[model samples]
Target: MYNKSHAQMPMDRSPPFSSSSSDSSQFSSTSSSPAKSMRVVLSIECLKGSSKADEWTGDMLQTGDIVEELRIGNMIVKSPFKNGKSGIQKILHGSFKQKETSIRVRVRRGCADLAELQACIVPGDQFVGRKQYVLRAIDDPNYAVGFIDRTESQCLDLQASRTSRMVSALERTPLQDGYVSYPWERRLVEMLSIPNSSSFYSVLFLPKSSDKASARYNDLEDTLARAHTWINASQASGVPIVFMNIQTESLLTKISGDTASSTVNAGSLSDLSNIANTSLYGFEDYHGVDLGVVRAVRLWFSPLAGEIPIEIRIKDTDTRLGFAISRTPEGFIYISSVIEGADDVPSARSGLSSLYKQASQSARLLVVSRISNQKLLPWMVSATGAIRCFDTVSLSQKLSLHRHTRVPILVHVYLWDRSANNANVGSIRARAMSTSPPTPPSTEAHLKMTARGVEEGEEDSDEEETVASDGQEDITIERDTAGEFSFRLHDFALKNNWV
Candidate 1:
């Protein structure tokens, strides 16, 4: 996982390199785009299993790195790759094998034409998952990606065309807003029904994390892209967007700073000061929107004072980061999870019960708990109104249910016996494994696993146990990766008129 912060790129900037073959006759056109040119720097995790340290001396080249065969001081050196991956082999298996190894690559930027470079190297299955170094395109200094190990810093330049095209997609997506709520589905639907109610809506955005920075999926990019789409669509449709800007406290530092503060504000995203400098959601030049910082507000905070609208607050209660969509006499509302919390289903349900009582008088509620916990099933049936209960055993099953429900759902995972510190990533992994199919080994499995391991925990690990930093077995119940846990819970709430 290569993690980077969210900094909006300017609009319509020309691609740093010429796409024309005449200008770039030397480099092959196989690879194009900023993401393609990124030289994914291998990290300590990448070399974790190596029996001996591997070395690189520009051993390979990205197919897209080709430029005119250079007469560098009258020495003709040819490039050996195309499009970053092994393009010569049409066999899919060959490509998978190439990505499993760690190899260095250098992408040449100027002098057009890759014919001379391609002519020298025999194309085959050698460069599959080989580590690549993309030198900065001459056009844009900021455009470069590769394995940047502390021991060795190698890179390859790319065409300006790659940068322009890659960054173009990023520019179109502007950050908007994010949200979260408790477990009560009815409460979420009711709160989300309020229109243009800012105070009740707490904007949620993903903060940059150390794990996130090194993450492979670029969650910030994905998050920002989502925000952009949501804001654009909602604004065009006249739906108000409530965004939450919550700060994440580093457990490591807080322990050293003051153990007392750590315990007082340990698990929740209550602290607003720990946010990274670049973790804000804003465009480079957009000036129309005011309020420089998105607020760290939650709908739960409103009922205490009774200032914000109750409908918006209801929507904000998305426990398990579930999803919800409601159509009431008031208006249409979409409820979704913007961030996740450390609470379990039982605790979340309690908070939600209180919130629902505040938001509406005749609100109905729907709930979903792990089917494995048969004891908890009856408690759900005891809830107010016609509570619809689903017997879902895993998160993936919850997603399957979501495909059919347009309303929000509440998903609960119980780690009642687990501690917080140990509850780290293992909990999320358990949720994913419980819902999805196990991956079968393939030729590319080594590279793919190593790549994922470098940034995130392995999906297939023997140990299902997780311990919190405080030596507590952190127990967590969450929605599956598909986000259906939330959706299903909310849908039940609306269909049964929980709110």
Candidate 2:
């Protein structure tokens, strides 16, 4: 169990432990009794994937030890150190305690701008408070063992909970789907959520330390209101939602002052000793939670990963072809690498490489722009009610409810070539619209002919429809009229010729 006196505990003892509260602002705290028979066995692993991993064994760790992050081995290495002055760390053996190196200082090392820093802390802080130290399932889709930070932040203490109101509210929060609200107590969740090649790091909430309190109850409530609205909207659509405090992953962008080094070079021995310091910008104390939740939802539904194209097939309500999908900011849900694959698929099989050759081998993926008789990319927002993105629920529901010999799923695909510098950056496909049937004209030349036909007294018998464009992919003109045209993708190359 954690205590106010936990700071007074010594290292070299043992861990009954667990642990990010954002902010250099004082972390919030409240203690409870941990379970007698714990399900989560927690420990801290330092310098994972680096030489330091060997040095900082999980068993030797204790609470309050000063730890710094070193970028090494394409990872964030958490190694133990002493503050410039002495610090507190506790170590509790399985059934005993051991003496640890603890020293008290007389003259405090003070900050230069104490007044400015003091203004950062807020009193009566209820909403955006302290960090969460334990994670478990209300119910989970993936195996719980995979996401737990078992090696490092593995177990709950005698009792540990979120110190802030916002943090606690989210802990163990349930979705209609029966999963916990958030499981990101550590980087392990990030690794599982994203591709294996990606690395995870915790963002410091309230990155700045302030002795002075500055939170207004009204403003904090307003922020919560916005987050709540989004959560309700997303839940109605069957996507699990959460309150994200620290943002750990983002699109890797290159900035002038902080150029990311080569993964191999950054992990070198020389670089290991000289770790990069987190800049002030890296320590942003964001006031609102809406943007973070929005990005998280966007990621939850995204399919593309590191520019590689992935394919997904909706087989049933609970069954899928592969990979967790996400919507691009452009509104199209592009496929990413496979996160999961069904053991039994009824689709026509072809070697992936052979399918690639259909597009001259430049294409690495096929994006599903349409499903059955419905479009994934919307042509128009329903003025009557809420906006829909990729009739996602409708697609799954169709598979679950409908009967078919083989589930005639028509998936429209576009080639995603990864060799280009601008990956998923902008609009990559072109379109020409038509309201008539027969062969659904494919060019401006055909559009001209259709217009000319109407002018020349030709009878346009087939019902007319509209397919809007994102200036990228084509629209569906045959969903209702032709009973979902068989989406046989004979061509996979992009019109851009990157193919």
What's each prediction's TM-score?
0.16, 0.18
**Which one wins on TM-score?**
2
Off by over 4 Å in 1: 1-200, 207-225, 237-485, 489-499
> Candidate 2 — what's its lDDT?
0.25
Kindly report which residue stretches of model 2 are placed more than 4 angstroms away from their true locations once superposed: 1-326, 336-344, 347-366, 381-388, 401-405, 419-499
Per-residue lDDT over 30-50 for candidate 2, one digit per residue giving the tens place of the 0 to 100 score: 112234222232232211121
Give the Å shift of residue 58 in candidate 1: 88
lDDT of 1 by residue, 1-499 (tens): 1111101111124123322223333333523545543434221111111111111112122323332222222233233323312222222233335542211222233442211111111122232232332222222222222222211112232333444534553576455587986666666556752222223322233322334332211223444443343333322222222222323322121112121111222244544334332223221123322222321111111111122221112123332222221221111122211112534332243354343222222111112222222222211111011222222223333332332342433333211111223224355323322322123333233212211100012232431222112322222334422224322221121111111
lDDT of 1 at 134: 28
For candidate 1, what is the TM-score? 0.16
Best of the candidates, lDDT: 1
Can you give the lDDT of residue 207 in candidate 1?
A: 26
